[model samples]
Target chain A: MRKVSSASKNADRVFRVATGVAASSPVVFLVVIALIVLVQAIPSMKFNGWHFIYGIQWNMGNLYGALEHKNGVTAAAGASYAALPFIVGTLASSIIAILIAIPISMFTALILAYRVRGVLQWILSILVELLAGIPSVVIGLWGIITLAPWVRDNLAVWLSHLGPVVPYLRGPVGTGLGLLSSGLVLAIMIVPIITATTRDLLMQVPILYREGGIGLGMTTWEVVRYICMPFIRDGFVGALALGWGRAMGETMAVLMVSGSAMNLLPHNLYSPISTMAAVIADQLDSALTDASQMAVHALAELALILMVLTLLTNFLARWLVTRTGRRRSTKAGVAA
Target chain B: MGKSISVTDLKAWYGDSLTLKGITMELDANRATAIIGPSGCGKSTFIRCLNRLHETSPGAKMEGSIRLEDEDLYTMDPVDVRRVVGMVFQKANPFPTMSIYDNIAIGLRLGGIRNRTELTDRVEKSLKMAALWDEVADRIHTPATALSGGQQQRLCIARALAVEPEVLLMDEPASALDPVSTLRVEELVEQLKESYTIVIVTHNMQQAARVADKTAFFLNGELIEFGETTGIFTNPVDKRTEDYITGRFG
Candidate 1:
């Protein structure tokens, strides 16, 4: 055994402390932001009580007058601070985005990882990267101009022929600025992220598994389906979670296409809706300029809720990844 | 039924680089043939060519003829050729997501056998044949990865056996195992030779001596000599074979 050098030991300690600080910095920032939102949200929380969360109506006509007669006006009557509409919009659009994105992303990933080769593979990979790098505002503008009109003239009309039997689809489609358009925009935006992550994960699967499948006379598709896909199932879930978080927080794109209406519940996929992020972005300037402190506090409360939702989503995703990762390690341990 | 294999002037390439160059040999039916060579000698590539797995690599190409009995392996569907010729790799590779039972039954299911009873019967029979039935019977429903390394290797053997192929190719199947597990695999191979034509590539000369009926020595992508196992070891035809056998050089 050799004696350790003091200089080297000091360097090692420096490296450890540097990395530890870097790792904990994100947690520190998250806590600070959360505390700020919580403090700002307290006024609205006191004024609106539970109705801010549970009530569906969002009328703000009497909010200015009610500010003067603060003691007499009920929370629901004064500010109409209920957030169910935005919550519904956020959940529906994000969920719909995931549902639309997953199949396309997985198939694209499979083709890129297994079926394609050489120059074509490189071309496709670069294309996906380019898609991810495109600015969200640009995508939102494209959605508003192109995708919304196409959907309104084509898909929405086709659905409307289902008639009164499908009451949700019976509503007049409004130039396609609605839940479906917003979800579609989100789906397109997240496709590259999900596909890239899934492709990388699929490629990471050990060659032994592929050979095992091939040796059994399985086709390339079978090898991917029976072996590679299951091996990276946890990674696929993580990719979906990554896309989910992105969709939930996407302000510019959703705000552009979602119509920003205060519809408590969407009538159908085509119905105009507003998400929490879209609402905050749309109203923040007006809320600041106006004398209504209630509106400002209410937006802060929504921001707090969005922050909590994001944190919960990330935590759940981390938990799920670890659970699957732990199971795999235990399996490897048992084999060892 | 076991099938004999004949290779004539076989050459294999990975991209532009030739790995197995013009190798010729005849493998007897229901017998174990051991291919012994040093690293980078293409012994593994030769056996992989028999099952058409070598060609699965990107830009991999092959030349000359490989015949299973009288049928041209090149003319047959590569997938069908693989089904007729099962392979066990140097590493144990049971599908990690599968249960012990499912791992064995995967080949059967891929072969379009859907009956539950038949799958179970074949799974059990394959496990028993691989000498793994007793050890894994109680945990057949558990993930295959829950077993020890040796058990997992046997599980892979069972998986290959369930498909009931005419020929089996093993590429240093026991090289990764401990001495005891190596001995168990060698014994299993000896038993397996009664039912299938087996070609094994090994780095271990003693393993070749223990399990093989005939031995083929490969060096620099060429066959140095091949004959009955005892004769090849005792009475070498080439100086290189003599040197390799005498442990002078690989």
Candidate 2:
């Protein structure tokens, strides 16, 4: 081995440090953001305790001694600020979106990756990419103007017939700006992401596997069903997790179409709901204007919960990927 | 139930480029026919066309006719045609997602063999035929990819065999293996020839000489010569064939 010169050794040290800093930057940023949210949420935590998360009510004037009567002065009525409604709404809509999005996106990805060819394939791929690029606000606007009324007139009426049998469908179907519409809009929004990722993963399956299946007299569909899907099962799960995270964080679109009601629990798919992000987006200005700083603190607490939710989702997805990856490697090792 | 294959004026193309041009040959039942050629000389392409695997490529097309026994292969469904004519690729690909047992059983399951005992028996039989059963019998539940490269190739052969195809096409199946593994595959091919018609494409002239009953030499996408293995190697029918066999030029 040759001895390194002092200048070259220093340069190598500097390069290593630089790369280390670059790699750790995102983690540092996340930590800083989490600390800020936690600091801001301290006041709310002191006032409401854990009820801020599990309590279902969302009145505005209930912050720390804000309504205490003193010196012959009548105090304003206190407001309740339970966050359960928003959490429920966020989870329900996201679940609905995933259920609707996965099958359509999977099939679209399959067709794009394997069946279609030539100029048509290129055009279809471009369209999917274009869908991903379109602004969420624009999609929200369209959902409000067009999709909402169409669902109200059509799906709501059909759903109403099942009202007596199913309690969830028993509520009056308002002009379709509610849980179902928001979920549908979310489905449309995330389809492109899921499809593009699934398509790329499917394409990554080696041509040899396809040849092996074809040689064995399996049809293209069977090949995809058995070989391609299983080979990339972990990837597909990761894609769905990504889509779920996106749906959970979605604000503007859900706010516009979900009717932004403070419903504790949705009675039907057509029932209006409010998500945490939507609540913060809808009331941050007013919360800041109020004399009591409790509302702002509550909003901060909500933001903290959302951040934690996002982190938990990512951790779960990572765990799943690593578990599957480990199993595959060990199996491969045994064979080798 | 090996079947004779007669290829008539078989021409293959990928887009506008010709890969195999008007190559005609007769492959007899229960015999091994080796196709030898230089790289890009369409040795692999020729065998791929026999099972319609060549046409699976984008813009790939084939003209002329291939008859498996009395049936015109082109007129038949490609899926059905592939069922009767199985292929093992140059590289071992034993469905990484499947276990050793499932890898062999998949072909049978696809062919609508639903009985569990029947599938297990066929998988064992095929594995035994490929001479891979004794090594893998204990870990048949393990992923097929866990096997060594040569074992994986044998597993792929067993997978194809499980389907009970009349003909098996192998493309340089031992080229990727060690010398000992190569010899094992060669011996296995010799035994397999007693039951199935085999067409193997190989770049190794020695491999062709060792296992092939009839040898076909291809050059520049055309058949240079094809004859009995001993005659093709011992005597020169064409200068190009002799040059290639003698290692004069690929």
Candidate 3:
């Protein structure tokens, strides 16, 4: 009979523990962050109930002259964060960013992933990665110094025409810190995330798919649009979700160029406003009243909401991936 | 030995390394021509070269002449050459993402048939010819991956046939399939030979013996013998061919 070894048992136990830790770490980290944000946000939500979310009047703290006390009511009483302006700012900037980024990023990613090769591919790939590596603050500063003035001076005539088409474009016409500025900055910030991931997805496609597509006599662009893109639509969506989340969470850059003005909504394309992040930066440190504190807490709640939205988007993309994965290499059924 | 596809001092290379050296043989059209050899003997490579699918790997180079009738396929466009000669792989590589119907339709669509009615007709005819129409007709709309191994091989055959190429190439088409599926594919090949010039590469001696009209024995990048299948199996003209068929060596 072979002797049982205690050493092997101990090694096996250690291996099991290590594997568990490796598997659970990411899941635990995500759950903990979500719980923390949600727990911190619960009190703010409890205070004003639905009224806090629906009410548009942001003048809670000083505007109402609410006094501080042992009571949490003063925090709820003072003029504080309203979802309306922050919601408008976020939607406006993100949409503008997507509009600008999607066309250019798609073209760039398509060129890099498919058409370009050799040294040019290497150089362009590096440049795109470098763009992603640049910090949000750097993008904001660039937008403020370079892009803002350039667009203001050169695009002034085009900017005026926007008002006639849309009610939101109604505003005093000067291109300083505004919706367009934050959006353009957001476009620059998100382009790399979208481009790099799109490139990776494109690369992961089997060479056979391209051959098969070409063998069928598809033109270069048609093959990409139909065969290549369709096969990796889920990945592109996943990249877009990441880009959108990054744009939503942006702080220093949007604040720098967003003008951080307390406004009801964008009356014009050049209308300056505060994003959720910008509001947090401006008000969190010196939240003088209880309502102001609640306002800060509300931004944290918004962060949780954004987290949930992106998580849901990721789930949708993952589902699509699995659906396609099932069919990649199956053979024909044997006839009975 | 089979249908005539004139080859003259043919050589193929991958980048700097030559894989097939000064090969010369005529492939008989309208008959199954089997090339049997060891794993790296370039039997599969030789068949793929026929279809021009060999150069799909970047830097794969072929020299000398591979004339399909009077026209040299190397001189003409490879895409046009590929369109003329269809290939089936070692593995039954059906596009799992596509439906059985769509899998058949894909090659036709690539061949530039825009009419849905024409695509549907061609898909049906090819499926029927491949002997897979009955089993798969009901589930034609279902994903190809949902099929059994034999069915997938037949589906691949149908996909190849859908384009209506002049010649068909198989690279161990039944190697991954079960015996029954292999037999079905072999039988399907016999039927396909009526219209298309058939070139097959098989490791299985019995499979080659059962189906091939001509057999070409290869070893270590060289063609040892090319003759009638009946003569090669029964009374091999070369000792190497005899040794290979008698189970003394691969």
Candidate 4:
């Protein structure tokens, strides 16, 4: 072997360090954000204890009152913060979004991946991705002006007929600016995301496998159902988890449509609600006004919870992708 | 029962570039017929048209009249034609997510065989016919992809056999295997020919001579010569066939 040039060795070392830093940057940012949120949340954690998650009431209480000390933390007299309603709102709305998004995205992805070709495929794929590029604030404005009214006059009334089958469908559909609207907006936001990911995955299935199904007398749909669909199952699931994380963390659109209800639980599907992400944005003004600063700390605690939730889902998505990817690689040969 | 195939003036094209140009042939019942040719010589396209697998490709078109035991294969539903004439590809392609049992059982289950005992029996029978049951019987429930290359190819044969087709089309089925595995597949083919009309497209002349009772030579998208395997190798009919066999030119 020829001796390595000193300049080439120096360049290689620099390249390795640069790539290493690039790869680790996301982890560094995540840890830093998590640490800052935890430090800010300590005061609220000490004062609120377990009630922060289970209790529905969220009163900043007498911002002008004398300070009270408890659990080594100081706050306004009579101040108490609990996040049950926000937590429930976050989970319920995101779950609804995922349920609504799955079928629509899956069928769209299938069509995009297999049914269309050439210019048509290009146009449809671009249109789906364009949906994702729309600003969330613009979608929120549309939700308030167009979607909210339609839900109140049309959808909520029509669905209330199912009250006999599902008790949650019972009437008393208020102004549509609430949980259903928030969920719908979030669904619209995440559908493009999941659909794009799924379409890419479907396209990646080798033609050899599909040919095997076709040669076996399987119909076109049968080939897709039994072979193509199963081949991409794990990746599809990972996309769903990633979509769930996005829906949970979304703020601008959900905040505008969620009706910003506080200190109360929704009794029906149409009831107004507030997610943690939306609440953090909605209450920042009022929270900043508290002389004791407890309200700000409580908001930070909410941020911490939201971060953890999204982080867990992202990790789950990566784990699922890698696990299934390893299994697929094995099929290539013994060397894999 | 095995079925004979008569193809007349079968011409196939992918987007105006003709791949199989007006080839007519007769494949006997319960006998292995090998189509031997260089790459791009339309031998693969000819067999794909037998099972209607050729037209599945984009821009693929074929003008042909193929009769399987007096039933016009072209007019029949493509799916039905495929059900009667099963195909094994050049490379092994087992369903990655399915177990060996599920891989074999999928066709039976989809064809509406719901009885558990019958499914198990058919799976076992198909695997045994492919000469793979003895090696994989204990791990039949494991993922089909976990098997070796040659074993996966055999598993694919078992999958096709479970459908119980009247004709079997193999396109260079052992080209990707090791020498030992290739020999095993050749032996399996000799056995399968006893029950089904088999048409194989092969690049290896020796493989064709070993496994095929009759051999057909293709060159430049047309059939140059076809005859008994022994005669085609030992005696020369067409100048092109002689050249290809004598290693003068493909």
Instruction: State the C-alpha lDDT per candidate.
Output: 0.88, 0.88, 0.78, 0.92
Clashing pairs for model 1 are none
Ranking by lDDT: 4, 2, 1, 3
Rate residue B79 of model 1 by lDDT.
93
Which candidate gets the maximum TM-score versus the true structure?
4
Identify the runs in model 2 with alpha carbons over 4 angstroms from their true place. Answer: A1-23, A62-77, A159-171, A317-326, A330-336
Say which docking band candidate 2 falls in. acceptable
Q: What digit string (tens of lDDT, one per residue) describes model 4 on residues A1-336?
A: 999999999999999999999999999998898899999999999999999999999999888879999999999999999999998999999989999999999999999988888899999999999999999999999999999999999999998889789987878889998889999999999999999999999999888889889899999889989998888988888899888998999999999999999998988889899999999999999999989899999999999988887777678777867776535544543211
lDDT of 2 by residue, A86-129 (tens): 88898889989999999999999999999899899999999999
Worst 10 residues of 4 chain B by lDDT: B89-98
Cα lDDT tens digits, model 3, B1-250, are 1235777877788788778887899987798899999888888778767767677665788877888878888887767777777788776656646788988887677667899888899999999999999998888988777888788878888988888888888889898888888889999988888888898999999999999999999888789999999999999989988998998987
Every model's TM-score: 0.91, 0.92, 0.81, 0.93
Candidates' RMSD to native? 3.7, 3.8, 4.9, 3.0
Q: Please identify model 4 stretches exceeding 4 Å from their true place.
A: A1-24, A313-329, A333-336
TM-score of chain A of 1: 0.85
Q: Over the stretch A55-107, how does candidate 1's per-residue lDDT look in tens digits?
A: 77765545445443353333323455778889889989998899999999999
What's the best-to-worst order under DockQ?
1, 4, 2, 3
**Can you tell me which runs of candidate 3 are displaced by over 4 Å?**
A1-57, A63-72, A75-80, A96-130, A153-177, A195-236, A267-273, A286-292, A311-336, B1-5, B75-77, B234-239
